[model samples]
Target: MIVAPPDPVVLAGLATTRPGPAGASLLRAGLHARRLLLLKTLLVRVQRHRETVAPAVLRGFEAGWLLLERAERARPDVVRAVLDYPTTGAWLAAALTEPLGPGLDRHLAHLELLAVTAALRAGVEVDLVVDTPGGVLPLPGVGRVESGGAGRLRIDARSRAVRIGGGDGTGSRAVLRRRANGPARTLTGSGPGWRGLRALPGGATRLEDLDPYRLPPDMGIPARAAADHADTDHAGWADRWTAARRLLRGTDRERAIEVGRSVDAVVPLVPRGTRAIGATLSAAPGAVLMTPSAGAADMAETLVHELHHSKLATLHELVPLHRPHPPGRAAPTYRVGWRTDARPVAGVLQGVYAHLALADLWHRAARGSRAPGLPERWRVRSAQRFDHVHDQVVEALAILLESDELTNEGREFARQMRKHLASLSSGRRALA
Candidate 1:
């Protein structure tokens, strides 16, 4: 028989996964992608639309809770540390698979883990010190907010408490096992063994104190990231496309849908003919990466870039693509390149191609450029044309140098990124 009631907060989450009218309508409004639909219709309630959405997000999470439970049993340490928040349920589900066989992919889980580690540190504190179910814990203050530190989070001022969506600091963590000891690791690396994780400097997660709708333990994201995450072109790339769609009203709707199609189209493209991914692309059939979330034409770039690899695979006749490299310590499930030279800028070149292609789309659609015929206007519009390219360029350059970076050119990149993002920020600026 079962021992406990699966945590009241978690139970409550299960009960409320059904999105009410507002959520359903929002889901209906932005069904561009099924995953996007999940984010919008289901995730928003858990992360953002608390009053109207808590029930639904929780319900979805709860429905998915068994996955978390299994993770606890299998790799308790990994899942506990990685799948710490409700937003992470999807990731948890994805991560649960053995991943060594065919039809196994942990891309979303990998990305989510990277993101949530920062989120946990943010909500808890950089040098956070607090109490936990295990014992006293101390979280080293990430000290400052940077790209790695969750680039200026979006905070909830009214509650006087900081939080990330699905992260309430109050929800119970699905601990598989509590190891006795270890040196210490940050929340990102912290696993079921609380040995290395910190308590952070706040009151306890208050797991028992939460209302049915209140955030569960470990639910809080840091207070520093009070601002929203902007995309390569300064577009408001909130976690979910539903939020993006809400903001993408009026003229942007068609464009947003077009972007969705553009991004989604890549999935089928790569899966079709992936015999040659190594000569040029290096990545494999499942190795292709994408981020049509915000800023830049990342969607098209990957479609084009990886497609280049797919054709490369065909050229070389490499059956299953493989490149064992990623950002984390584990075998690299992902790979990114950095620009060694700022001049003849390779990143800039890519940015140009991406922008020009999207520009072609814009022209073909006959959507007049906003505020054309100006110096800065040209610069900004140009950035939007290849938001993905520019975003990647700046990010790559930053990695390459990694010292007092963000030079004038980098600033220029940021400036244009911000503008293009702003154009999409209101969410009302969809394609023509």
Candidate 2:
């Protein structure tokens, strides 16, 4: 689980919010390595806190850890997939943040569930006991098993078949079938206790995650709310995503490929009118929470914008973009033109970087007729959007350049952004 810093050229390209496929792949690899390292650190912490952890929980943790190592040795790719799942990161963050108590126990127990998922995917034998907090066993990137009560859940995986039994005296039993190469499929000939993970129709992108543990606690989106929002019109959501990807690929094939590489899962959010709301968590590198929109162009822009945040978040992990906050002093805040309230330097940087991409997106769309399906009204509006977001990005970049909170790498990144913005402005003027 060795991680390396991004190449200087890659950093510069990412600063411009246009890391090509190669750069994006590099970032993805670095982020994946970081996640694997975090998993190891978490396991070490669990071991140190064994005294506080219940005896049963401690034994379960040890078993899961051993199984994880075995699966990693047998099928590294399958184990890596389980490690890179967005929920895995969220679970790691939760487990690390929780104190030594029942809260810690509850979160640490998720590692066993993750191990079970990896074992099932790797085709390794698994006979493990995991805590089912609310009568639910969530296999990240796979589906969930819902028993009627909360207690321990027994999972046994042999060959390509898995048997799940409720350990809470409910006598609940369900069986799941797994593929020889891919993720575990939906229940086959099993009792009525679980549902499969639904995927939206995007050629190479996984567009939806309905898992209860999809989001971290700090994200403020309750599992029930996300589940409710995901329940309606998955076909409609798939149609909009297909249209959006088509529009993006038509406009810029490189960027469409980059988006598919950077974004692994889309957590659907409740929409607000015609506007699409979106958010990216720093801890979750490849996941974006976005509201579904019927407008293809709007969805395309949201995807690019959120992808910028995801990339920047991953980049910051390897490179110290901002200076550490002073021990007792509050971090200084700035007023970026896009947001109403003042924000810290990191937030400002994220906004500027994302908007820079949006500005470029609209700039190209405003000038070119490559995407014939783009609405004429949107084409007309592209100029206005370009000017508005372009100015906002310029203003935000100025703040970042002037701030003392940025490290040398951060300053260089901002300068590279300035260069990109200048190029975009020159292109706009040439069209004018």
Candidate 3:
């Protein structure tokens, strides 16, 4: 259960809307190659509706899309990882029912590609059974399928014998999780636990059945809001939640459990066209605020990123990572490869540490190759990308150590980071 800080005011700037397309911002800001592909997806969505899209939206989306297209062709693996994702369906459903005005620059766009990568690792598969009238819908990896009931779609997972569809009283939307395996039971949702492997949270039977009271307060994510709750009926949000929680269990169960236990609460950020898909507050420890992600992989990584913050927050109480910037000497700033924004030493440290975990995650992902149909070339490329991130982190660590920010403990921590990086590098070299 999440504990509340007394009189916790909602974090300000909860709704910062940038006018341009979210994809363009990603390109201009410079994102990792894996993420760049996701920006292109948002652009693709814009192009499909160019005639109807607003000028700012079309211009930004097209500019970013064209830039990426000219520089590189969209990889088949990247595309398949995306379009075939379960959350992509939920995101599309949300966009259709809830209109958020012009300039559809939601961070959720990036989540699509991230989900693709994560779901593949989870060993989870699904087939979208849609009820459409006319032509066969081309769903990249899944191929063409026919449907009759115009706006209705059903998601089925044969492996788990689980199906999510309309029948649980959400009207056109299917938020209820009906276990079709043995006896029929309509579960609201579940959390991080994997049955038998780990115990579920108290009172929670299904993974998608989240404890609303355990939700954090500062980040603006609603805990109690659901399909039945007015103003909280976020179309496909319920389904998206189910997919994210399940993916976490399937792909990164241990880490998910760690996060659930450490973090006080998660605040779901409404998409406001910002480049950041997720964020954690230094002021408000254990609180993570984020937009809906593209898929399970995206959610998994986002959890990793924010949970790193939670860990660091706990450590910060004990040891300082950096000394305060000298009074009046323009605070030192450095470029974070993940973002276009320049960050101070503290911010950079935060990013570097989080990315250290991500780098390692991808490194392990590259080595094992558990995901079916993942290409060899893509694996090599991913390994190279994460190695590059590791190198950057090492560099950042060096620069930080040189500065006078070390309490004996901080220096030791920095050394440990370097030691870990060196070990990972050596292991990769041996593999090569």
Best by TM-score: 2
Deviation of model 1 at 417, angstroms? 23
Which structure is stronger by lDDT: 2 or 3? 2
lDDT for 272 in candidate 3 is: 53
lDDT of 3 by residue, 302-354 (tens): 76677676455434443354677779789878776676888887786677678
Q: Candidate 2 — which residues are off by over 4 angstroms?
A: 1-6, 166-173, 182-191, 207-209, 218-224, 272-275, 430-432
Score each candidate by Cα lDDT. 0.28, 0.76, 0.44
- For candidate 3, the per-residue lDDT at 264 reads 39
Count of clashes in candidate 1: 77
Q: Where is model 1 more than 4 Å wrong at Cα?
A: 1-86, 89-253, 258-432
Predictions: Cα RMSD each: 21.4, 2.9, 19.8
Winner by lDDT between candidate 3 and candidate 1:
3
Ranking by lDDT: 2, 3, 1
**What tens-digit string does per-residue lDDT give for candidate 1 at 1-432?**
122222333222211221133322322222212223333333333344334323433343443343434434544444333322222333323323324322222122133223323334323222111112122122221111122222122222122123321123332222212222341123232222222212211211111111111111232122111111121212222222333332222223444443332221111111113232111121122122223333232332333344333222221121111222345654311123333434333333233323333433333222434433323433344345434343453453343233233333333433443444334334323432
**Residue lDDT tens for model 2, 1-432:** 224555788788887787576667777787788897887788788767778998877887888888899989978888887888776787788788888899888777777787888888788888756778787887777677776675777777766778888664346467887777654322343665665565656543554454666665445534323535336567777888888888777767778877776677888876556767878778887787887775888788888988888888887877879988989998899997888899999999999888888887777777765467766666667788887778788888999999999989899999999999999898776433
RMSD of 2: 2.9
TM-score of 3: 0.44
lDDT of 3: 0.44
